[model samples]
Target: IRAVGTGQDALGEVTIRVREGSRIVQGKGLSTDVIEASARAYVDVLNRLASGHARSSADSAERELAQGGVARP
Candidate 1:
């Protein structure tokens, strides 16, 4: 149903479900602009669940790239 909502209409709602241990976070948004709703849902997920892992991984990657990695002038 959620995929159908996001895929088949210019205006519809989207929901994302994420769970870990006993914790669950769900988000929903509706918009005539599909990108807007998608962004909203993704932001919600990142805020609720994805913040730490993604930031740590991104920081690790940045550190690797900064460590005299191959570079172009």
Candidate 2:
């Protein structure tokens, strides 16, 4: 995770990266409010993680099976 603030009003830019197995997911946020930017960046990554969008479908299916869940056909 990396965050930077600039300008007089303190515009914020945040970058969040997450790694799962061989996959790497990145999220970015920019806002005048630093806290809002941070939350947006974090939530962006969380949404991807929750949706399994960072991993390949095949990988996700394999993981599901390993966890005793039904695999997608």
Top lDDT hit: 2
- The digit string of per-residue lDDT tens for model 1 on 3-55 reads 33344464656776555554455566667766777778777767867554323
- For model 1, give the 10-residue run with minimal summed lDDT: 52-61
Worst 10 residues of 2 by lDDT: 1-10
Give the per-residue lDDT digits (tens) of candidate 2, residues 5-66. Answer: 54576667888766666666667777787688888988888888888778755676788799
Report RMSD (Å) for each prediction in the order shown.
11.2, 10.7
**lDDT score of residue 43 within candidate 1:** 76
Q: Score each candidate by Cα lDDT.
A: 0.58, 0.73
Candidate 1 whole-model C-alpha lDDT, 0 to 1:
0.58
Stretches of candidate 2 above 4 Å error?
Answer: 1-10, 55-73
